[model samples]
Target: MSQNQSRVTEFILVGFPGLHREYYGLVSFVLFLVYAITVIANATVFFLFVTNRSLHKPMYYIILNVSVCDFLFSTTTLPKIISRYWFQSGSISFIGCFVQMCFVHYLGSVNSFIFSLMAFDRYCAICHPLRYITVLKSSTVHILSVTAWSIAIIVPLILAIRAYPLPYCASNIINHCYYDHIGITLLACTDRTLYSFPAFTSAMIILLLPLSFIVFSYCAILIAVSKVADSKNCVKSLSTCSTQLIIISLYYVPRCFVYLTSHVGIQFSTDVRVVIIMLYSLGPPMVNPLIYCLRTKDIRECLVKQFCISTGHPKAQVSVVTN
Candidate 1:
């Protein structure tokens, strides 16, 4: 610590610096609604997965992991920002900021890995039907899930550990809504490139590695689907993969654009950048449950059955068949 450098004990989060004061309530309300929807939808999916024995397969297990990650990520980030805008409270302790940063990146990375896992699962199912069952056994799925979560922790922790010791003698006001790696590190009173480059590289690796595998998996899946003589089976295979593809596009495309623009010197306004970040981060969690419910036959049937049972319509029956 330099003698001239003063330690920052807390940080102020500026939700949207350019926005007028009158819209604070509206912004806060919208954020609250997003939070509420994300929580309810993800919780419902998770509950269905837990209670329904029929959903106890490897594919649903992966979906269950994603549901847990989505809700957990939203929970980690949304409350503070909502409070910041709603209550005019934005101060967060320095340690608290770093803690939030850890989880934000941690969950994001976990989701990336989980998506790759989903792609792999789909690839096996579509490309090699004979070995799919043996390859993605219950124990294998458990090990992969645990490994994805465990490995995702390392990069963020290292970034946090590195950034925590930097001298934050400059401004404590973060320009964004929540604690994130670049948002906090840029405030340090030193050369940010040393930290920023590594952070950027790690982020790219976390994103691109899974993305590459997903592409490869899908390409192989497409080739396999082309060989199927039965058009119905081919369409069914494509339909199953389409849902995962929509989700992957939602998760990756915006993120890739953001990272690429930064790398290529194309800059967006702070508000625009923050809004884009919020959209990509919050959008997937909000819609993932809906996507699964509408697309997956088993989950949809289970949800409908549960709804009927809860409504005291035990004799009411529903069945969904997709081809």
Candidate 2:
């Protein structure tokens, strides 16, 4: 390690640069609100999944995985930025920054894999209806979930291991809301491409591999749905997929745009880039629970049942169907 590395003990996170101090409170409040909502909503879903045995099927199992991922992702990224704005504390220890980067990328890769898992679950349910139950038994789902989460850790750990000892002697200012691979690597004194290219490659592989699977799965699903003779059944099948499709779009589209633009030489100002990044990163966590609650009948029914039970109206409880 270079002497400069020792000199830079902490990094300053310049969140949404050039904003006047007057708006700090407003930004902090909004960010805090988002963090609060994301935590509560995701926690509610996790609680429902845990407490209600009826929600233990493969699809809901995948949903449970998603809620857990969303919860972890938000917890990993939000609090520091909220503190940065609220308490005017943007300084993070070098080791803390690297740890944050590792978990941020790790959770993001896990999310990609989980979405692909969800797509695969839907594919099994709709395309292989006969084998769905046998193929995706609870034990099988647990195995797959463990596999996805376990495999997703490798690239991020590798990236962190490689990047952690870099000579970050030049600048200690991260021009983003939170620590991320690229932002932190760019601060290193060495040629950043040495670290960045591998990170980019890993990101693409992590993103596109599952994305390819998701696209193929959904297309096959559409074909299968088309073959169904009954209009009501077809409609029902598509309706069942609607929520995942919306979430998939929300998660992937903006990310693709950001990656594509950066790779192809299309440039965005730091503020614009950061804003876009924050929007895509934070937007999904905030909206995923809302989408599930409004769009998932079982979850809604469970919520209603819980609400009714809490309010001393057990008679008003809605029965949640076990799939």
Candidate 3:
């Protein structure tokens, strides 16, 4: 409860130091392109789910959640960065910084939870085919979705509340692309360890716990598939899990490296850090919908129908998402 415990009025976000102002226009364009793709790709899946009743199944519902989270996740961080580059405005109000930090972390946690839930659903569908319907009933899906959203929202709230009263009597400059929890917290005049350790620990728990669950769920799945009577069906089922694994890998593998780089005292240049963050954060959302359309026949068919109608080529089964 010192002077540094007072809330800040605003924080200046210093985007990539290596990215010179001369290249701001280039960076802005790139950020805008990535944001547009992220939004459009996820929005396509969301639109299809909302308008088409055929996609109302349990698996599709999980996908819908993924799309929603992706869209929100991109929204929470990208626009501010875009504005920073486009308009040369990197100053975010204290509350606005908190809002961005909260949503970025919360939506990320929600996505992690949803991925685990999706793994669990797949495990049930493939391993307990007979009980799949009973196990993942509509009501159960609703409860799980609500639980995921609630947990995600609460975890960040606790962290924000803890840091809310911290005095920011020092330079209110965040040396990052956007208003991130650690970046914002680093600006405070208090002992950095006081907030950093807890933030780091909670992040690890949020990340590792669900990841462990996902691995276990998939292990259970592989074992179950190995015991199946028909080899072809077993392969088919494994393929499904493999596709999902690709999505999981795309989302998580970079994070593992980033954590390693930070922990082992490996130095990444400002531009390198920014690029790394953009890849993991924006890459998965941009690619996930395309994965669904290409890897699954049902989703592919649905998208084709939508494409043909929109282009007025009703006879052709086109994959417009690719284009």
Candidate 4:
């Protein structure tokens, strides 16, 4: 192959294959609305957490971190996609694609880890209420928070670096929504499997580690809750956990399907597969804030109190345990 042919300077993301030109307008409009809602919803949670002094506890801090991750996760991929569908512009510079791919994967991995930390916090809070304060002190939260961000960013950086020197001689058209490792690696003129498989396996490992941790912690939580003599206490414990469990499943289940489909000979049309991918990446951030607000008492209290006080209403208390 000629040297010039091997040098790839940019890539074209074909937003969602099979949609063609007819539906771009509608798709763009919907994406814009979803993007707006995602930002607004998570930002409100993050802002509330920051502004409210009563929310300085460990669990709320975890939610605050998750909120920030949710905002960034959507921000990384949505704007690029919105512009692609809106303007018929899908071209992204090589460096720009690298940055996007890094953050998309980075924030994803971070969210998984963050969820695991939350599971740990819940376990301590419920199973060992006395030690909970000591286990998740402000210092510990800061360390764990920094660790999640650092590892998430570093691992994806290594993956991106691995793809850095690869030559894209064939074509630069990415067949999915945003600049993901799989889509970008597929365009490389070299052995696509050679480049793709290792990265795929690494990602699976990163995903599974947290998933395993979450499972074990939640199981332990179940055991602890079961031993409680009061049935009401047991139910309350399980109820608090149910929302986190739902959020965890939302984040990981579709991802497992997408990953397993490749190796198991499952067939999905390009559009269907892309739709699944969109849900995997976008669903958690959209649903997490709602689940927390609707399920958790303290955060709703924080939200209501913050809104009311900010609007000049008298101080008030709010508490409703959702069943």
- Candidate 2 residue 39 Cα shift, in angstroms, is 0.7
- Error of model 3, residue 265, in angstroms: 3.4
| Model 1, span 221-318: residue lDDT tens | 99999999999999999999988999999999999999889889999999999999999999999999999999998998999889978887766653
User: TM-score of the candidate numbered 3?
Assistant: 0.93
Candidate 2's C-alpha runs over 4 A off are 318-323
lDDT per residue, candidate 3, 115-220, as tens digits? 9988988999998889999999867988999999997888799888887777888788777887778887777777888788888998888988989999999999
Give model 2 RMSD, 1 decimal: 1.7
Give all candidate RMSDs, comma-separated.
Answer: 1.7, 1.7, 3.0, 2.4
Q: Give one digit per residue, the lDDT tens place, for model 4 in 1-323.
A: 55855567888989888887888999999988888888999988888887877788888888888889999988889988999999988899989999999998899889989999989989898988999888899789889999998888877998899987787787888888888888888777778777677887889888999999999999999899878999998998998888888888998898888888878999899889999999878878888899988888878777777776777666343322222
Residue-level lDDT tens digits of model 2 in 1-323: 57668999999998999788999999999999999999999999998999888788888999888889999989999999999989999999988998999999999998999999999999999999999989989899899999999999999999999998888888899899989988988888888877788889989999999999999999999999999999999999999999999999999999999999999999999999999999999989989999998999888888888888889875576343322
Q: Which has the higher TM-score value, candidate number 1 or candidate number 4?
A: 1
TM-score of each: 0.97, 0.97, 0.93, 0.94
What ranges in model 1 sit over 4 Å off?
Answer: 1-7, 318-323
- For residue 206, model 1's alpha carbon misses the true position, in angstroms, by 0.9
Ranking by lDDT: 1, 2, 4, 3
Which is the winner by TM-score between candidate 2 and candidate 4?
2
Flag the better candidate by lDDT, 1 or 3: 1
